[model samples]
Structures are given as structure tokens and as C-alpha cells.
Target: MRDALRRLSQGEAHPFDVSTGWDVVWEHARYPQKAVLGLAAGRLAERPLGPYDFKAGECRRILTRLGFAPVPKRSGGQESDDADDAAEADLRQRTGLGPTEKASLIRARRGQGIFRQNLERVEKRCRITGLRDRIHLRASHIKPWRSCSDHEKLDGNNGLLLSPHADHLLDRGFISFEDSGALLIADALDTRVLDQWRISQPRNASAFRAAQCKYLSYHREHIFLGRED
Candidate 1:
């Protein structure tokens, strides 16, 4: 756990997968305090907790510390932060925070902030495709945000600007990158099908930043499916 947390905090490679990590951690943490700590550490979900589900003020405190001001929710529900605080305090009293827990929270919070700032820096557009449609773009973490505690999640160097489709491809390892910034088309990618998707033009290989390339190295080694031309 310490090793995982350390990697997450530094934006280094980690083994955790985001989509399932949160649910798994939430279910496994016996203590509410530990669970809340996990959530705050970016171990629960890639995005912020819901506003209606959490008091604006409390959420603001956490987000503010991480450099993200909580936004008002359009819907309604009991505030999660209030409930979380109550539950966490009880659990914390029952079992004080361990060293691992404290480190994880610190890392998670910092990482999340870095991610938000990167999104703003790129103006939330796919650097390669140049697609600027907000709904179709994603703040993609090169090293998935959820895998790290807090600091790793927010590190701008750990992310990439991509369209939803490109994000999906990259996220799933169907596509990846070389250190030189060349797109590593998956071997299993059907050329006929790819042509229909309109992604054939070879990119200039200069759009990716050095930090972004570091994360891509992980994807290339661990995820990219190299099957075809």
C-alpha cells in the first residue's frame, strides 16, 4: 500500500486501475474514516463527489485545499461531506489514521489539483485531433487519476488532451504512444475499420510534451495491443 501510494503521489507508474479501484477500496475499507480518506486521496473515483451529495462548504474545504473550488450542483440530495465527516470522525476516534492512510490522502489531494489545472491549461481540447467539443473531450490522465492518491492525480504532466474517442482508445490500450510522440496503433486495429474512423493520417509527433511522453511509455509497455500494420 505504501509503495502504491508513493507511486501515485509522484506521478510514477502504479498498478491500480481507476474504474474498479474506487468501488473495491470503498467496499474493502472497514472503517468509514479510511473510506473517506480513500475518496479524498483519489482512490474512489476520477471525478469529484457530487455537490448535492455533499455539503457545499465541506466540499469546498477539501477542494480548496487541493486548489479546486467546489461547484454548485444542479440536483438535490443529502450532503455527502457532512455525512462523511460524521462517519469519519467516529472511525478516526475508534482507529486513528495510520501512516499509510495519511500519506495516501496527501498524495491524492495534491494529484487531483494538478489534474484540474492541466485541464484548464489545455483548455480541455484534444491536442492531437484538435477537437474542442467539450462534451466529446476528456481530462485524461496518462497515469490514470484514480490509480494515484492525490498528488499524482493532479499532476499536469501525468495527463493528455484527447477527444472522447481518442481518450477511450488510449485508456483501453487500443492506442498508445512512443517516446517520440508517434501514435502506436494497436496490432488488433482493423485497417478497414480504422479508415472508417478517419484516424489514418500520421501525426507530427511533436504535439506530446516530455512529461506526457513518460506516461505514454507506461501505456506502450503495459497496455497497447500491437497486432497490425
Candidate 2:
């Protein structure tokens, strides 16, 4: 997969989001190592563990083939759920390539060109608040790059241009949008952060289209943190 990503960087591939590159591989390995990698990948525990089992020795071999470091016996010890969580958290912090990001990576590997093409069409401004600082902006996923297909990534209808602060919250399921393009804050956010960003103000008179609203719904459902009053 890394080889494919390198090839992609050489201009032979589509424009893929950096975060999405890991998702594709995780989905591939979800089956055999569901318990081990599943916890590592941060899937809900409600999901049943797959019947498949491999001892630490065997898991080490599989991890080698997949280009990952072998799981240490004490280091999660192959499907030990408690330790598995620890290892998973460590991997996530180091790589920022959680399950969601893994899915994004896979999509990126498949369609590098198309993703870039679409991002170009989306103007470099926050579609929500119309903040236009380039250094502070990000090309956000509407359907999310990981779950998105090549076509979806390229679809102008499936994205929002956002500033980095807003993008960080949006990416982490912290913020959402109203049907009318108003910024909605998560309850978890300190009131100070909200005031700092001026999230209380409604969007200016930019006349947002329904397409933006459509994507906002996904953000609200999947990414938005905290409950509404």
C-alpha cells in the first residue's frame, strides 16, 4: 500500500487526502484480525469479535506481511481486549490513522487524480462562515474521504471549504451545521473556544445553496459532538 502511495505521489495517481490513506488497508485486514486490529482500529465493542483467532506468533507473521510492526506479547498480546485498547490508542496517537482515516487512505490509493481535480473546483474558503485564510483553511469531506468513492471525492457537491480551527472540530465530530448553514457548537467545547471563534454569529449573507446543507447533515450526524439544548 505504501508503495502504491509513493507511486501516487509521482503524479501517476489521483489526489488523495493524507488522512484517508490508512482506512483502505484496515478494511482489508478487518477480517482475520478483527479482534486484534478491530480494537486497534477503534470499532465499537458492540460488534462481535470474528471467530478467527491467531496466536501471538502467528499474528506476528501476518503483521509482517502487512507492513506493520509485530504485536508484542505484553503489547496487547493478540486480541487481549484490554491491552488491545492501549496499543490501539498508541497507534492512533502516533499515526492519526484511526479506522476512519484508514478508510480514507484506501480511497486515496485508488483514485488519486480525481480527488485533486474536485478539490480544485471547491473554492478555498469556509463554506459555513466564509472565512478565507489560506493557512487556516482545509478542504473538508462532505461524505468524508474515507467512506467516499473516487467519484464522491471529486463531486463538488460533497465538500465544505473550512478554516483549520473549524476543520479540526468538524473532523473530530465536535461541530456541525444547521439546515440554514449556521454554525452549531458541540456541548463539549469550552464556551471560551466558542467565543474565541465567534461561532455564535450566523453565517453572513453569502446565500448558501442546499448542497451545502446536505453535506452539513452528514457532519451533524457523524461528527457533531455533544447534545443540543
Q: What lDDT score belongs to each candidate, Candidate 1 first? A: 0.49, 0.48
The C-alpha stretches of model 2 lying farther than 4 A from their native spots are 1-117, 120-124, 133-136, 202-207
Q: Kindly report the root-mean-square deviation of model 1 from the true structure over all alpha carbons.
A: 17.9
For model 2, the local distance difference test gives: 0.48
Model 1, position 26, has a per-residue lDDT of 20
Candidate 1 weakest lDDT stretch, 10 residues: 18-27
The reply for model 1, stretches above 4 Å from the true place, is 1-114, 122-124, 133-135, 227-229
lDDT of 2 by residue, 1-229 (tens): 3443333334442222221101223323312222333333223455433323323234334455677532211111133334334543443465544676545444432323444346547555776556776556566665665444435555665766677777666666556667655566655567787688776644443444676566666656443543435
What is the per-residue lDDT of model 1 for residues 72-111, given as tens digits with 9 covering 90 to 100?
Answer: 2211113322433454454345556685665444343333
lDDT of 2 at 108: 38
| CA displacement after TM-score superposition, residue 4 of candidate 2 (Å) | 44
User: Each model's TM-score?
Assistant: 0.47, 0.45
Count of backbone collisions within predicted model 2: 17
Q: Give me the displacement of residue 22 in model 2, in angstroms.
A: 24
